[model samples]
Target: MIKPVKGFSRLSKKEKIEWLAGTYLKDQPDDVETLKQYWNEDTRLQQLHDEFTENTLSNFYLPFGLAPNFRINDRLFAVPMTIEESSVIAAASKAAKFWLDRGGFKATVINTVKKGQVHFTYKGDKKKLQNYFDKIKPVLLESVKPITANMEKRGGGVLSIDLRDKTDELENYYQLHCRFDTKDSMGANFINSCLEKFADVFEAEAQRYEEFTAEEANLEIIMSILSNYVPECLVRAEVSCPVSELSEDTEMSGEEFAEKFLQAIKIAEIEPYRAVTHNKGIMNGIDAVVLATGNDFRAVEAGIHAYASKDGKYSSLTHASIENGEFKFWLEIPLALGTVGGLTSLHPLVKLALDILQKPSAIELMKIVAVAGLAQNFAAVRSLITTGIQQGHMKMHLMNILNQHKATKEEKAKIVDFFQHNTVTHSSVVEQLEKMRKG
Candidate 1:
């Protein structure tokens, strides 16, 4: 067992990962050996270690940190984030703190159910299908009942089912949409499992006609389906900061800054380049927190990106403005995360992070994550409006660079000071550290 730090009663997952990774880097052991030492399952960790060593190891090691002092819907908490991009942590923390200086933040999330789509292609007679609605619809919907019993027990089940036809795009093809209430789980696996039953139901109903051959009729079911970003069953967060706290650091009036921020929002709506990076800033904090908590970051990323272009045009995910002379921020994302399954159960460090959170349900986890997304967005927009993103991130990057060079703490400070003064170069950092070492 590893020893705990003196002051840290509850280290977040990012912290735990850092502690283990830093130890591994210091010891510089074989990858497999490193995996075996900290991770529970040697076999599983070894595979991950190999994959990480060969590919995307650089992507994996981005500096992960936590934004502290967040009060979401009157609950005090900290948000775990992993990012290499500069100023995100500082910006998020400052935005959160700004709200706290008022009455603290009040963030509320809906029931947190995610919709799973089941797509299929049927190039049968769309004209004849107009005469076949009742028979096919009831049977198809009924077939999913048994599969949804467990979900019903947990107070969630099949909420609704929808169907659409697209003959203009693809000839003689239609789409079947299955909208299920996943309860507290991401429900991708569960939803796909029920698709076969639904397909069987449809096939049996259609087989009544001699011409309706599922095989010969060219029928295919596309599982791992897509989700629509509907306003109903949406996750929304509203953060308000009081004008009193705006005076703490006043190069410009809070009202003046708010107007400038509002103008930037209008600009981002029209500019694709700014919107892309702007949304990325929101994800930087969000993806880290999700990954740290053992949620599927890929699905979340896909959903958010898809939601960005919902208007048939690209736009920023976040909207900020100075409302009534106080900063008001709003964000919406379909974060389909589950608290009690998969990696949360298998991973050692994930369990440790959950224990620190001490939330009772999956909905609670969603609330925190949504709030983190908002905090991250707030931090980013504030940075862009103020001193730019680089000034804050460069310091942290220097610390990492210093650590990589094995510079002593004093040497790190000296080199970092030199770095702040001018552009930092690896050779220059090494030479400076060497001179500091000798001196």
Candidate 2:
């Protein structure tokens, strides 16, 4: 069994790695060296990465790739994606090129509202609480002025505050529901600061209110935090073309493929199992961009999945339809992204990724991110309704398997040619590679 060590963080880098390798990694020399190899050669850069979070270790790297020829809102963009999964960028690129001449993609920002709350308990007259809230609303807003000053100048700050009665569901429970315009930020820290201040003012003012009974004045503040469920901070992205365009290179006729595509989407929409994986396909694109751009991918995932189940049952995030001889596919998702803060300014790759994207504002990035998802879903659905998914995914995954076997450049070239007409499966690729190796 493993045991904790004192001042683990104070240990020198070499000693830390030595201890970790000795304890958990069996002290494997090559594995320990491999971990050391990933450290940045520049000590300053390594220190920056080390200070990013608590524990200090070698860098964990993911491939940062680009999907070219994305045309959104009449502008061309080569979107950057950072993810470990294979086939995501390839699928997104293929879809982007597919829609390049078919009016490209269209995206619109629906809204940019964010939220936070202060949870408290009051076991007094609800009528008195309401009147007290009405009286202290301005005071609560004013209490957070110092916290909101900078954000307010950025055209983002506290928008509204309300006291919500929730005693019906949980006895004596109420919430200080607050909303904000965070503009270009994810705004967790800002909103959270404001909420804490709101809680402070709320409880303090209650004590001073002449009409408040002793019980009412002693309300207990449970917690104050920003919500990741941002339904109002939404963006919609779409692609459409005449039905004839849907047949571009597929075997099925345009009309047949369009109807099949719609049917597939319908199944995902009304079915939970399919919708879960279906939405995951969309996130494969969205999360990559969110990660690459230094925004919070986990928060984006939580909010989006919450939105997926907004109507009760979790369903597809992307929608497809055929109307008036045209096939349309689109996705509307809530994404709270920031372009100027967090890792966006600190991480080297994140800065470069934003620059590669032409330094879009938060709104523009929202549209690009959503378009990436819509494009990804379009490619996934197109393959599913026609050739099936594994054909392309496994093909893209061939090189990963080859790398595992340490295939030489020459061997990889031959394997690539062999799979052009042949189906790709692990066993089949293994057999062929073995045969090639013997020869």
Candidate 3:
């Protein structure tokens, strides 16, 4: 049995690797070499990556690709995407080129308000608590002025603060709900710092409020943190053209395609089962951009899914409609992204990705990210409505299948040619490769 190791973090990089290899990978010498193979040759660069997180280990890598010809808001972009999945970039690029002549994509930032909360338990008189809260609201805002000053100079800062009573749900539970405009930063650390200060000041002020009795004045501070769910921080991206314009390259006419597409989206909007996977495809586009740009994809993912279920039932984030002889496809999604802090200035690849994007501000980044998602959904639905999804997807997945079976270069070329006119399945690819080798 393996025993727990102490001071693992104190171990040097070499020592850590040795310990891991000896303890866990005892019989796997090749796996040990594989771990060291991925390390950066530049010592400084490798050190920087090592410092990114605890337990310094070899770096994991994903392909950083670009889907070009994305014309958003009259400007063109080769949106950077860092994902390992095959065909995501291809699908996005296909969709972008399809819309390039059809007025491209239009995106707008709806709002940019983020939120945080200070949860506390106060078993005091409800009326007196309300009175005291009213008296201290300004004080709560005033206490965080020093922290918000720099954010304010950038035209982003604390918006408002309100005390919410939730005693009915849990005994004596209450929250100091706060709103903020973080501008060009994701502002997780900033919002969290301000929230902690607010909690400190609120707790300190409660003791001084004479209107509150002993029980009311002693508010137990629970936790103070920023919320990932920012419904108001939204952006809308859309593509629209005459119904006849959607007929390019597909077997179905524009009108038939539009009707089928609309029906598909409507099903996603109403059915949770389909909506989950439907939205996941959208995230395949959104998350790639989010990760490539060094923003928090997990936070963005959480906020977006919450917004999808905002009406109490999880549904599609993308919607479509054909109105007035025109077909429109669009989505309004909440994305809190930043281009000024965190990994934006840290990671080398992240900086390059931002530079490729023309170094957009938070709002511009939001618009671009939303458009990626919209374009991705358009490609997916378009494929689903005509020629089926696998025709394109399995084609993109062909190389992966070939590589998995260790096909040589010449074998890969011949096999790829054969599949162009034949359906691609794992068994079929293996069978063809075996037949060729036998010959």
Candidate 4:
């Protein structure tokens, strides 16, 4: 049996990999070489990657691709995406090219407010707590001025602070709910720093208040952190054209395709089972761009899903309708993105991705990200309504299947050509490969 490791983090990168390989990959001795193969040849660049997180073993890579012909707000762009999935980039690209002729996508930033909270417990009189909050609110704002000064100068800073009582939900529970505008950066650290300061000052003031008893004055701070559910930091992206224009290449009439597409969206909106997968398809596009830009895709995912269920039911993020001979599709999602901080400045590829996007502001990034999602959904639904999803998805996945079988160059060409006129399935590809090898 393998024993637990101690001081694993203190181990050098080489030693850490040796220990991991010996402890877990003993049967596959060649795995050590496999890990080393992925390391950057340049020592300086490899060291930069190692410092990004703890227990640096080796780099795990995902393909960084570009989907071209995305015309958002009348500006053309070749949006960058980083993901491992096969068909996502293809779907997004196809949708972008299709819409490019129909005036492309229109996007808008609805708002950019973020939130944080300081939770504490105090068995104090409600009226006294409210009065104390009102009195100290100004002082609380004043205390964080040094931290917010730079953000303020950039036209972003603390927006407001309010005291919330949760005594009925949990005894002795209260919180300081705060809002902020961090401008170009995601501002997680900035918001969290300001929140911790607020907590310190709030606790200090409670102790000195004359109205509070000793127990009430001793407010216990649970935590101070920024919230990932930023419902107010939202953006909207949309595309619309006459129903007649939607049938450019499809076999169905534009009106028929529009009706079918609307019904598919209606199913997603009303059925939780379909909505989960439907929204996942949208995120396939959203997350690829979010990761490429080096912003927090996980945070964006959490906030967007919460927003989807804001009305108390998980539903579709993208909406579609056929309105008076016009076919419209759009999505409004909460995205707390940054163009100036975290990995955006540090990661080389992230910087490249930003440049590819024309170095947009935070709001601009939100709109672009939202449009990517809407475009992805449009492509997916279009496929589902006409040719069915698997015809395109399986075709895109054919290359991955070929690689897995370790087909040679000549064999890959033959197999790819064959699949163009034939169905693509794992068993069928293996059977075809086996036949080709035997001959």
Worst 10 residues of 4 by lDDT: 122-131
Model 3 bad stretches (over 4 Å) = none
Q: Across residues 1-439, which tens digit of lDDT does each residue of candidate 3 receive?
A: 9999999999999999999999999999998789889999999999999998999789999999999999999999999999998889999999999999999999999899999999999986889988988999888888989999999999989999888999889998999999999999999999999999999999999999989888888999999999999998989999999999898989889999999999999999999999999999999999999999999999999999999999999999999999899999999999999998999999999999999999899999999999999999999989998888888888889999989989999999999999989998778889999999999
Every candidate's CA RMSD:
9.1, 1.2, 0.9, 0.8
lDDT of 1 by residue, 88-166 (tens): 6777788778777566655556645556655566766665654554447767767877888888899877766666687
Model 2 quality (TM-score): 0.97
Q: Tell how far residue 416 is off in model 3, in angstroms.
A: 0.9
> Per-model C-alpha lDDT, please?
0.67, 0.92, 0.94, 0.94
Q: What lDDT tens digits, residue by residue, belong to model 4 across residues 1-439? A: 8789999989999899889888999899899999999999999989999999989889999999999999999999999999999899999999999999899999999899999999999886889889889998999999999999999999999999999998889988989999999999999999999999999999999999898899878989999999999988989999999999988779999889899899999999999999999999999999999999999999999999999999999999999888789889999999999999899988999999999999999999999999999999999999999988988999899889989989999999999999999988889999999999999
- In model 2, the Cα lDDT at residue 381 comes to 87
Q: List the residue pairs that clash in candidate 1.
A: 73-107, 91-379
Would you list the rank order by TM-score, best first? 4, 3, 2, 1
lDDT by residue (1-439, candidate 2, tens digit) is 8888889988988889888888988946688888889999999999999989877778999999999999999999999999989899999999999999999999999999999999999988888999999999999888888999998898899989988988889999999999999877778888999999999989988999888889889989999999999999999999889998778788988998988899999999999999999999999999999999999999999999999999999999988888889888889999999888799889999999999999999999999999999888988988898889999999999999999989999999999999999999999999999999899
Residue-level lDDT for 132 in candidate 1: 57
lDDT of 3: 0.94
Candidate 2, residue 210: Cα displacement in angstroms equals 2.0
Task: Mark the regions of model 2 whose C-alpha exceeds 4 Å error after superposition.
Answer: none
Off by over 4 Å in 1: 1-65, 82-87, 110-113, 209-233, 416-439
